[model samples]
Target chain A: MKHLIRKDFLKEGYVFATRAAEIARAAGGHTRPARLASNENPYPPSPKAVKAAADVLPPHANRYPDETNKEFIDALKKRHGDYRFVASVGMDGIIDTVIRTLIADGDQVAVATPTYSYYGLAVQAQGGTTVSVPRKADFSVDPEAFCRDAAGGTKLAFLCTPNNPTGGTTETPETIAAICENYEGILFLDCAYIEFDGTDYRPLMKRYRNLIIGRTMSKAYSLAGLRVGYAFVPEWYEPIYQRAATPPFTLNMVSQAAATAALRDTVHVKKIVSVVQEWRQRFIDECPYPVVPGGANFVMVDVAPP
Target chain B: MSPPRKADDVVTELAQKGGVIVRSCASFPPGLPDHYIRVSIGEPWENEAFIAAITDIYQP
Candidate 1:
């Protein structure tokens, strides 16, 4: 039975963060555990967004979601100019789709270390090799090191802005431009936490044909449970993305409605961002341990043994 | 002050005793140290609870 599965699948799968239920069980059945592990928004979606989902549920319960996801795409385009977009179940789904499209077995995808663990997992699932370039001691990416590691026939390079766990923008515009100029492979920038940082890297898309920026409604938009992820793809790669994308109806009708409404409700997103920013600073300022200076909603604390 | 604890031990202590959960950076491969933990910014009360809990554990 094991021989029938892919060799990589035989190895350990991606380890998710401890769930709330697990936390409760660990705490001797304490039900209300403080969840500070997964970097989820500490707020709920806007009332309007919730209402929009509820408004459509009864009528669309028996129907399939729009295959093209027109409403969601239109909302996205309105918010983020008229660039080619690919909406998926979540950013994870988009990553899987990209890996499927670009990586053939034995190809290499370059990644910066101590960033999103999923990029490496996704690459491995595709039977592709992950070429890792370690970030500097400060956790900032070095363009020269990245390009050098990715130089020899890597198919794709994944970078996360305001990177996960570390919670800060590791790469600057100049670093991005340098990587794009030096590395010939496709550059996939995960901007999932960009709203918290408030730096728009979208302009880089205009300059780099190889750049693809991924966004999600999970964090600032408070739609984590809704599973809405989208990406601003380069115009030239739109056709390829369309072909490689997950099957239609990846987002159900309710999710589409909720996400569209959430996109329009910028006030709620702004509030969430501001509050997280404040809390992030407070956590850094007050923590007795040495904390990494970060731009996202989380901070990495060094608790190494003396 | 008590000696600093490993990231995994701190995470376990926090969850089981403090009823607060944070991510151990052990899984972030190739560079992150075993002494590092990632804590997400929670609600005001939740954040305060985390700080209090970790402080108690670290200092005690």
Candidate 2:
């Protein structure tokens, strides 16, 4: 990874959005001011999540965690049907595992451009060339043109719903089917913002054998700090993931309790959702700029001033 | 509007009486006038403060 780091990088500070933040921080002119970037929920974690985390704080701190994440996976499986659920350190790690397990060296991975930067960066780190299929003018996925070039060792195609920066979604199931049918690679549909989406793709699991879905306990669940995410791989791909993953038992314990409690406290989560929705409406109405349409908790906006 | 930080953007001209901080949104994709500024959808009090600040800046 240090090979990726450049000599001039030290001269330039950490470039993971530090410039934009510094600009915003300077404009806002406060050390500890409010921020609404990074697609985070302004609200705090739920009571159940708080208590669950609290339980492991002091007395139970001495124990190593259970490796398989049975209780949490059990809860998830109940909601999501029979799928092999593997827990990673977090969503980032899960993405890492997914790419490593599925992608052989020099395997092609395609993702939507101007979408999440992590997909490209991660793939590139593993000697895979990331082909970006740009979205339409309105930012919807063109499944035909996208999968048309799915050749030469293309192993994974990532789909981000209510996609980042654009805040648009690809809801056309027919197109998704076409992509899966034509391309032999696994479709890694990352639905981190599913709670705010206009629809669900869970039922389509039966149709596409190559489809793999990712869910996070972050935004909608408000468990960002807990760092829990799960990927439901097809039975064929399950062994592949398990083989590549480091199933740290203790990490599973923390996420298991936090995620289960988050799942249970749906009502509270809904309340926070309602508030964000209200703010969404208010933002749209009062917007001085043309706000991009999105169903998720956060809005992607461009501030162009005359 | 942000004040000049680097040496390149030295603010030579002072803010005259009718000077307005206009945010252009011509670059924003779809459905906005040229003078569009994107503000986050904030809490009520935060919204109020933003409203007050903009109102004071433009209307005053």
Report residue B46 deviation for candidate 2 (angstroms).
4.7
True-structure lDDT of candidate 1: 0.85
Off by over 4 Å in 1: A19-24, B1-4
Residue pairs clashing in model 2 are A65-A249, A65-A250, A66-A249, A304-B24, A305-B23, A305-B24, A306-B23, A306-B24
Give the lowest summed-lDDT range of ten residues in model 1 chain A.
A18-27
lDDT string for model 2 (A213-236, tens) is 788888878787888888777777
Show model 2 residue runs off by greater than 4 Å: A1-15, A24-31, A247-252, B1-60
Best prediction by DockQ: 1
lDDT (Cα, tens digit) per residue for candidate 1, span A215-264: 99898898999999999988988878778876755899999999999999
Per residue, candidate 2 scores C-alpha lDDT tens digits across B1-60 of 642122111100001111211122232223322332333334555444443444344311
- Find the 10 residues in a row with the least total lDDT in model 2 chain A: A10-19
Single out the weakest 10-residue window by summed lDDT for candidate 1 chain B: B51-60
